[model samples]
Target chain A: MIRIGIYGLGKISRRVIQGVLSSNNACLYAVCSSSIEKANIFKKEYQAEKAYDNYERMLEDRNLDLVYICTPNYLHTKHIQIALSYRKHVVCEKPMCVSTKELNDCFDYAKRQNCFLMEAHKTVFTPLNQKLFEMISNEEFGEIKSIDAQYATRLTEQISDWHFSRPGSGCMFDIGVYPICYANRMAKSSIFRVSRFQDEALIEYENGCVAHIATSWDVDMENTAHIYGTKGSVSCKNFWKNTEAAVNGSKITVVQESDFTGEIEHACTCIENGMIESPVMSRKASLEILKVIGV
Target chain B: MIRIGIYGLGKISRRVIQGVLSSNNACLYAVCSSSIEKANIFKKEYQAEKAYDNYERMLEDRNLDLVYICTPNYLHTKHIQIALSYRKHVVCEKPMCVSTKELNDCFDYAKRQNCFLMEAHKTVFTPLNQKLFEMISNEEFGEIKSIDAQYATRLTEQISDWHFSRPGSGCMFDIGVYPICYANRMAKSSIFRVSRFQDEALIEYENGCVAHIATSWDVDMENTAHIYGTKGSVSCKNFWKNTEAAVNGSKITVVQESDFTGEIEHACTCIENGMIESPVMSRKASLEILKVIGV
Candidate 1:
């Protein structure tokens, strides 16, 4: 089993824990939290082997094969460095660092430590996104035209407590990365510059293709990504799930296509066979992703 | 007296000639057309004293104050140069010249002529857009945030023959420029770069703000500009009307705030006052606008 110790007792951490336990090749070995109260509560609740109130103490356990750094924007670099120093493979969240410079440093350190590192950009790794990319490459959609992707959530009431804090806690880093990363992959180009309004940035590429990204921690949206091509168009109602396509003259309504089958077992097999060689969350792609997030 | 000659007997020329002749300070003194038959017809229709079958013959009419160029895209630079050769001022429409290099040539001749010249981006002088600018400047909506503006018209069935031709004509120049211009004014920055997908390009600034522009000449849209700010948001349902704003939490929507009552009239007055020192459409702005036209 690939034993894992998860850090950061947030909602995402909880979700990851559940997904890990549910996966056949993964097992949750321990949990760590900054808050002692939350750590003890989670240790009792999840019935894990141990709970450490401090990340350093949690890293002392030699039995853990890997560590998942699911912390906030600022602590990612520091946490990853410590986890790698302890000779553990690491997977961190998106917008891996504040700047490309910091990301470069992390990449250098990871090479020196000889530890596996991934940014956990799960959207690109999903079965739905793969199918969409495959169809696009096969010229199934004629020629690519434009893409509009938005992921907005009402975080004002529920998430303002930690989201608007100091040291880069904002919508762009948290949720904006979703659309930015998706648009970059769809267009297959690095965004050179970004035009920003209140919270929306229209990212532009060297080739003159533009991606309209709308992300708000204070609004409500279903996280949609719509692709408009020459012959037809395909849209993901939420993230990359349930994609629907239509051509220029079709009288189609704005309904989500219901037939996209999830390739859960296929992705698991890819992982087990070590066939997923192209890391969906590469350091170069993450650097480009962070440039928009830096805004 | 500002004596003006109009080229091209197209629909835009029809309205512009009428507007210019109706103005007391400007007179539509001459008409030019590639076809002598059309020139004679236009001369009789508009009651213009002079008719020129050739563009050079009209340029020889040295008494003309300005030449309003309404020819096809490829002919703009050629006509502007001919007009400027005889020291006549020029007013060309949007997408001033087919390409940025061509636009630069137009600027060079305008400088050589030492006369007034501009692209006719009249939407900026519209009452609605003017009020939108003032409201944002006064911080009436608190801090400015994001603006989403779209201009789309269905063209599949209605596209004119010339619209699909190779030399010029597309959505980016036709209706796309309006949103881009408005967004530029509202955001008050030059676009860093643009992304081109098929026939569309989305523009963004370095600040992380975005502008969504679509022009299909083949699709129908609401044709509106939505401006979102911190205190409240304002929107204009139609480009030709004034926008309305509400203080973030308030129920009252104020339409046509007191400051800008008659914007087009003010533009004319500015012209009369030599406050029109620069043409209504500055050469620099028009050149940048042409860059996104992707010609």
Candidate 2:
């Protein structure tokens, strides 16, 4: 099994620990946080093998085969570089890097180090979406004609300051990436034209498909993703972490222990195969998300 | 009572006949078509008093107080002008005019002739939508913040050549006006910015409301309209003619004779009140729809 070290003990790391614990090909070996107390707390709760306040200290453990970076958006590049420099495979959270340049640099460094790397877009790697993609590839719904996905939430509680003023901030980078990644993955085509207005975008694909992706923090939305095609359509509510979807009105479901497990398992599988990067969430795929963000 | 004459015995005119016949404040007095046989057939079937093959012949009748113009889109300006010339109040079908210039010209002619004129936007005039608009105006769902409306259908059957090659021909002008008018009416604020991509548009309203309206002949969409506010949400399926809506989880419904009756009755009410245009669908309101079309 891949020995996974989590590089952040934020709220998302709790879920990552659950994912690694549930994953067949991975184990939660260690955790690092700015607060050693928090790191030790997570280690005790999730039964991790080690905890460290320093990222370098965690990376120095040669047994750590993979690192999962869940730091804030602006710090992703730095975390990824340190993990990769240790010759460890890495899975970084969404908005992996703010722009394409940062993305290219991280992947290029990973290439030089010969370590597996990928952006963790759990929306596409979820078993439910994986099945839908396979079905769409088989033309079950005919050629995709259009897609509409929206993710909006009211900011009810306090959030980190970086979410507002950092380089990779705002609702688009925070939550918009969910709908953007979902649409781009299902489209199975390259982008043709994109028009961004506020937190919404209309993307026209080279294969004659159009997608409208929207996000906001002002109000709550349906949080639904709809895929339309010539033959029929598919829709799922709360699609970012959904375990089920309606395929032309028929329910297709998957039992998921943790939504993040599939991505962890996939990342571990890629590392085991001696792959330098995930074929599914490759550098090109990571760049496409930023391309829609116009970075 | 308002004695109504319908011009252009096309497919939509049948519904107009049903509306007028069922209306308590209006009578279907005359039917006009280029084909005298078709006009005579419609008049007899709908119990009209007269049938004429020529527009001038129908307008010659002194009792024809109102003319409902259902001509093809590109010809709406001409029909509205001639009807106003006869001192007849007019209600033209959607795509009232292709451009703001034509809309102003026709309304100005109506003003000079002391005749009432309004565009028949059935989506806004539908009884259910009127109630929703009133509820929104009253802030029953708090302040409106976002609206999303879409109408799309596949071209399964051959349509008229005008649908492909006329001035107001594309999907945006054809059925797109439904969602545009719906969003504009619900927003209840002036437009701030608009981004048009293919047949989709994202509009920001002055009061901080955002609307995404879309249409296509390439695919069939959900055909739903969602109005989200600060506190709650409202959604209607097949919203163009829906008689019911879900308000924050509860169903609100209205009984209707024909979907077109509300607009026809509103037009007749405006003429009876000695008003030059409908307060609900004023000259400025009609211009806003065309403005979003970017014509």
| TM-score against truth, every candidate | 0.68, 0.96
What lDDT, from 0 to 1, does candidate 1 have?
Answer: 0.66
Runs in model 2 with CA error above 4 Å? none
Error of 2 at B264 (Å): 1.2
TM-score of the candidate numbered 1? 0.68
* lDDT of candidate 2 over A1-295, digit per residue (tens): 9999998888888888888999999998998999999999998998889999999999999899999999999999999998888898899999999988999999999999999989999989898999989989999989898899999987899999999999999999999999999999999998988877778888888997888888888777888999988888899999988989998888989989999999999999988899988888889889989988888
TM-score of the A chain in model 1: 0.81
lDDT (10s digit) by residue, model 1, range B62-109: 676678888876677887787778877777766667787887777876
Fnat per candidate: 0.11, 0.34
- In angstroms, the error of model 1 at A141 is 2.7
| Docking class for candidate 2 | medium
RMSD of 2: 1.9
